[model samples]
Target chain A: MIEWLAARAGWPARWLLALLALIMLAGVVILAASIGEMPIPLSVTLASITNGLGITDLPLDRIQQGIVWQYRMSRALMAASCGAGLALCGTILQALLRNALAEPYVLGISAGASTGAVTVLLLGLGGGLIGMPMGAFLGALAAFALVILLAAGARSSTTRVILAGVAAAQLFNALTAWVVSTSANAEQSRSIMFWLLGSLGGVRWPDVGLAASIVILGGLICLCFARTLDAFAFGEDAAAALGVAVAPVRLILLTVTALITATMVSIVGAVGFVGLVIPHAARFLIGPGHLRLLPASVLIGANFMVLADILSRIIVPQQVLPIGVVTALFGAPAFALILYRARPST
Target chain B: MSLEGHELRWMKHQTPIVDDVTLTVQPHETLGLLGPNGSGKSSLLQLLASLRTPDTGRVRLGDMPLRHQSRRRIARRLALVEQHATTEADLCVEEVVQLGRTPHRGPLRPWQPEDERIIRQVLERVGLAGMRRRRWHTLSGGERQRVQLARAMAQQPEVLLLDEPTNHLDIQHQLDLLALIRRLALTSVIALHDLNLAAMFCDRLIVMHRGQLVAEGTPATVLTPALIHEVYGVTAVVERSPHHGRLQVHYLPDLPPA
Candidate 1:
């Protein structure tokens, strides 16, 4: 039925469909914020946001202000930014690897980030706010560099690239596990476990801003190379024949995606599924043109994350599930459906 | 507009694929390369297309060394159509053709009217105008080859390199595609397995045996019965086609033994 509608609507109508999805995403965010503890009204939440932005004179109580501004707003922003970043990374990775199964985690970016965060937490690198995230960023960069080295050495075939990613991911996972096992403190182990599963529970305004900047910058960079990404979808040799400087472009894209994935991992822990699910969802809406697919993936990813975060909050009474669990729960079934539907035709 | 390779030697895993071969294609000329399977026709074409770097030789486009130019710069002047169209993702016919404009387009500018016009003209030239929105996978083998041709044409290149373009095409479509290539005034280097089609379409023929160029000239000069027997180990009779005034080959099948 959707295919029938899509066929008649043309390309312009697809854009309209994407816009409608975006509106629905915004509605989900607002609804999510209103459903939490203390039951803040929609008008009160809107007024608080407006007041925070210095747009109106609608005054709110301090606790109400804290609820809207300090807690829910940052949480929502984190959800959206992480979602968008993961999805964008997934879209780029899929093109780069030329495999639909390629995602940020599959390439060891998440494992690398988690290892970094775990190292900092176990070793007690810094007694301040900046220690864990910085460690994760460096770790992510290291993993990215190692994967590039392996893939480049093997001449960058799709099979070799995936193998390199899998090898690096396993190495990092083993190292992270060792670190957690040897650590004497139970608190450190618990924290590491929480991070590996992912959460947006403790997001502050600064973390929100940082995540947003990384996502925005990374997203813009990816979009700027959308044509190159399109070239990659045809495989490396075809892209090279089309004049893409394959190795250098792949390196730069991998680095940029690594940076964005690290920033997200630092802020919200290692959220899965958003990177894997959102691109497929976007492809379902728009065709495989990277020009449309990248931006649409970002929007849909953000919406998916926000929706997942809302589900995490509402699934239990006064107890929020880790965001990663919710994403896995929703994403796995959807992924299965896509595979099942795609299998017959393929 | 001219392509020249000097003492070209290429190796794959230390096994020579193009051994000390020298060749040239003049502007507005079609040069057909013919060889038995594994005789390195495609490898030589890859060298000319700059898809592979020769181990110890130089390739020149006009007077400029091919290695010195950026890929985009070279792509603007020369385009290559590989044997198979194997993309991981599906694209419509028009979208695939539009990829030809990659070299001509600036990074910041969106698709302009001229790009669209050229793409449309090329698609029409290839007789694929009606399949503009059809997914590439939905197209038949012949249609896919035409779409690939349209993509190469959209490049508006001075030189075109085709590797076994008629591999999966029907005989009629193969003839039609070769005819289209002949009509285009661009310098073209085509690797073909069909000697008859190559003889009819190409202005010059280069024959390779065991990764070495054994003969080079007009088809009538190079495609002797002796050369065919020596290179392809097939006994064949070369005769004139009454319908087209072209040379045609009829191979003698081996007889069954008691």
Candidate 2:
């Protein structure tokens, strides 16, 4: 049935699916937001969201309103944004490299962010609201610069760029581990470990606003290049013959992915598997056209992250499981299945 | 109007690979580019198509310098079918042909009726009208070659550049492919390895020897016994065929390691 639906979907049907997914995602997000220790009802959660939007009066008391509006809703939005951003980046990277397995981290941007964030958490660089994310974004830019320099010096093959990224990731990951292990106190170590594993606790409204804007804006910019990305499926020479300026397209996409990775990592600390897994699943669901795949991946990824966040909260009776742990628990098996199934065709 | 280049040169690793080449393809001419291995046929096609920039010279389409035209403008008027064009995606034949419409449309333009019409006509022209839904990985080598041709045709180009297009084709498909190119009556330059095929279909033949134009003229004027030996380093007899009235080259086998 899903195959029939995917095969029959025209432009109108695809847009309709996106619209339906958007509506379903809204319901899922609200229901998940209602699932915590406070245990607000779905009616109250919807009412709370509507009341905040000035659509209706507050149905819940002050404490209930605060919990839904100030805490859970913002966290949910952040999860959706991060998921959308990471998956979109993965989709672009895969096309750019022409490798099915390429993800946001394959370029070492996230590893560089981890190193910077760990250093800030341990040594207290700048020691304020602006310091942590700023440090991490800078680190990611530095690593990306190194990657570009290295790739330019070589033959400019996609494999060579990927190998260069692997080297950079190893170096940055080692630096991150050293920083965390040697300098962090036990209490700091506990908090750092939870974050490294992907925590979404205490992500307030400001982070949600910033992240959602970047994701949506970045997605729009990427959409403008959807045809160009499709041209790249046949490799750079074919794309060039089709009037795409290959170097600029590649460079702009790399910068965009790096920025997305840096921002998401700084906010939620390296939420692994979302980038790698969501895009492939979306590709399977929708045939791999970027114009369709981009929107579908965004919606599907948003749903996945929100559900994972909900599962993390409800798994332990009182404690929150790290979101990355839950994603990896599911993502690894799916990744293996994608690889195993891919062997007979190519 | 013609598509031509002047004194074009390109270097690879500081060594000249396409050195000081100049040529012309008159309107509706099927110019055959013939050369020995490493003799710059492919490099010259790339330069003419503006897929590669000349280190020191210019290509002109009609009266305009190619560098002055936008990439889109150049692509709309010129199409190139490379020797081994490949795509890793699981696209069907129709989707692959639709890609040729990229230069004709902008990011915001919806796929139009005219574009669809062109796709359908080109697929039919290449004898793949019924195979539009077939996936790329499932096709045979000759089918893939025809799909590439269909794609190039869909570009609606004024000048079509092809590099070794008959490399993977069966002999029948090879003949059919050349026939289709000739029937289309587009300004085309084809790089070919088969000397007799070039002799049979091409309006004029240009021979490249060591990155330079060694000879250029009508098929009868350019193809000769001595020229084949000089250009290909092989002994060959050339005579007009009774059936087609074109110079037919029959190559002599090499003497054993002597």
Candidate 3:
């Protein structure tokens, strides 16, 4: 495997690996879509997606088509893109911040998004999930501003940034709890808590469109800065000495990752662990080079999320588990094991 | 071309750390910045390297001010090896060395064969010829220092600034590193704690006392017993060594400077 990734083969091999990942993701998507109640046939599921995508014309009943394309397919795509965006954010954050444990939400975007989402849900600000993402976007940007402002006094060190993020997370968590406890009764608060845990139960075409644009744009921007991010793998001084405009570039990349991560949280309600663990998992398979690790993390995260969502839907039969719970359940242990093994044992 | 500082002053928490330091190094000369801990040697070196901007003074490379040159331009011409620099993650020696070529490449430019050749040559020059794939955390303290030196050399710099590069090295590696720095075809400013080593390795030595350049000249003239006692707060005897015909300093045990 190392020989295959060696520079003797280089970019062509990377592209080939990416192509294989893409093919596997497509296979997973079709398979995951066909796993719901009523058991849509794989052939019909493929036909429905291809037809919905306008690739081909096929005979299909209206209800089955709706179930396959409108419901299952849309949810799967949202999971894929959200996963990609979150994983990409995590990868960039880990490198730029010079910390392996730095996750997508390390800058407090998810906490802020949760605050915005809870506010909208309790007070009926946007009346539904529609305005929730808007609130999340605004709150994410605001919380990020606060983190930067709080950390600015500390000389922009990584420890300071993470600490500021933790502080912001606590502040926003308080606000979320206050809103939910005050405005929402027991039934409404239960739904609010479930949403906070993250759910993809009601995903539709608009959610996919909204998330895909940012994920693709953000991923492209990250790709352009892959070499700069690689420079950061050493440290800030080394990166600056290598001609990276340290101050501005770090601020821009942090904001860029926040933008993508905020959108993902709004869509998926703060899906956990994909952002924290998938990047490290990808790094283990491929070495720490951002050029390869960035793309590998995206593909692997997408696949992992799609599978998790499928399991969430099918686990208890008519009682869907929140996707966040599923990820946290599996992701936390996997991450701990990886961390234990990766570090030198002194 | 010369690297010069004009009235360089730096302050931390309302206290001056580098106090009005003005110095210059001729092209291809080895100038040692010798001072004790917190005596402003690192601060002054950082000011000269363009890594840290002074509060009241400016650094000039040739006719241009340090700020006038773009960071890429400065990086191409100047390289600094920090005293305690370490990678946050495990990277192979080759990967670490290849990062030195970053200033020369950009978004569109790919890594070239010439960069590869330079990396190979520097690795061999540093006596790490077959250790390209060695992990950073696995290397000894001395090997890490040599890796840093190789990285600086790969920058193709016109001027190099090193802060305590030999701090953790064995005696042999320390001597070898200084000799290599002297032989390199560039101007160098190295900070050293060992006055005798600095005297032997440096073409000229600048002694700092209380954030001031107390003396500057050839090692033989600058490293007098009185100056060493004054700056470093230790009674020392300075004499010419017959073996190398340069100034050698021997500190009196438990004796304080008067």
Candidate 4:
């Protein structure tokens, strides 16, 4: 349906699609905030949010209002931001690396960030001088640098890059496991394992602020390079021939991806599959033009994550499954579908 | 505008791929580069395009050093259609051609009437006007090459560099493409394999053997039985075709090496 509209209408169709996606995202976010441990009505949730923002005052139960305003709202917003950021990274990586499977989780960025966060938690690296996000950022860079180094000689080969990423993910995951097993007590290990599985239970307003700001900033920077990324459709040499400053643009964009991935990993642990699958879905719906693909991925990813979070909360009897578990459960089958669809015609 | 490469040398893993190659393409001239396999024609074309920095020499665009100009600035005046250039992205033909306009447009600039006009004109010129919306993966090899040519034409470059663009093309397209290049009269350096096509289309010809320029002149002067044997290790009889009034080469079976 969207393809027909976009093809028929051109410029106006993009705006309409974007508007539709934004509305869908808003609806899912509201749905997420309303359906939780304590069921709150949609009207009360809206009133509570508006009241919290000093936009409107309405009578509401204090506990329900507090749950919606303080806990569910922040968690929902953070999920949206995290989803947008991850999907954006996936889109950029797939373009630059020219591989459909390239994403933060698959490329080892998330695993590296998990290692860094675990180091901060158990080993007390930096003596609390550096925060978890900073540590994760450094580790993400380290893993990325390692992958690039290993993949340097075969830089044009996408398969070699993915292999190098597999190597980095194994090495960092081992490091994370070693730290936790060696240093943590039973209770600490349990908590660390839970965090590693991606829990959004503890996210608050501050986390939401950080995630939203980084995602917005990163999305904007990526938008500015949309045309440059398009030039890379053929390859690096092709991009250079088309007047893209390949090296600097690559460095800046990779750094931004690492930063965004690290922030999300540090906050909510390594949520897999969204980054890998959302971009493909967005491309399928909107085509491969980065100008539209980037925004479409962001909005779709936001909605997908919020919906995933909602499912994570409600799927069990009085228990919350990890967000990563829910995402992977859905994303794995979707990934298979994408791969099946992508098979070359005989 | 003239494109000149001065003493260009590029090495990969300590082995020279393009060695001390110096050449020039005059304005409105189609210069054909001929070579056997592994003769460094592709590398030399890249060096001339400034896509790869020469190890020890410089390329000049017009009178200015190519290294001094921004990539965007160079792209506006020069374009390269790389051999076997393709993408995994599911881009339609028109979208792929629009990529040619990158150097001419900016991020904030909306698509203009001129840009659309150029795209349409190039598509029409390349004979893919009706297939604008065709997905790339659905196209045949020959169609893909023509689409790439259309893209290069959309760049509006004064100096065009193409590497074996006729590789996958049919015989008709090969002739048509060369004739089109001739008609455009743009400063072009084309790496071609067919000696007859080079002789028929190019104003001048240069031949490479083992990363060195071994022959350079008009095709009539540069192409000879001795040069062909020495460079390509092939026995051939070179004669002017009466039908086309151009040199045509007839190859003989290889004599057993003694």
A173-236 per-residue lDDT for model 1 (tens digits): 9989998999837876776687688888888999999999988988888888888888765667
Taken over the whole model, the C-alpha lDDT of each candidate is 0.84, 0.84, 0.83, 0.90
- Candidate 4 residue lDDT tens string, A1-346: 8777766777777898899999998889889989987888899999998988888888889998889989999999999999999999999998999877788888888899999988987788999999899999988998999888888832458778888888999999999999999999999999889888788989999999999999999999999999999999998998988888888899999999999999999999999899989999888888899998999999999999999999999999689999999999988898778667653421
Lowest-scoring 10 consecutive residues by lDDT in candidate 2 chain A? A337-346
Ranking by TM-score: 4, 3, 2, 1
TM-scores of the models, in the order given: 0.91, 0.93, 0.94, 0.97
* B45-96: candidate 1 lDDT, tens digit per residue: 8888888899989999998899857888888888898888676577899889
Per-candidate DockQ values are 0.51, 0.53, 0.52, 0.63
iRMS, candidate 2, in Å: value is: 2.2
List residue ranges in candidate 1 displaced over 4 A.
Answer: A1-25, A56-58, A124-131, A145-167, A340-346, B237-243
What is the lDDT for A298 in model 1?
Answer: 91
Best by lDDT: 4
Q: Write the residue-wise lDDT of candidate 4 on B26-106 in tens digits.
A: 999999999999999999998998988999999999987998679999998899998887687998999999999999989
True contacts kept of each: 0.55, 0.53, 0.48, 0.76
DockQ of 4: 0.63
Which candidate has the top score in DockQ?
A: 4
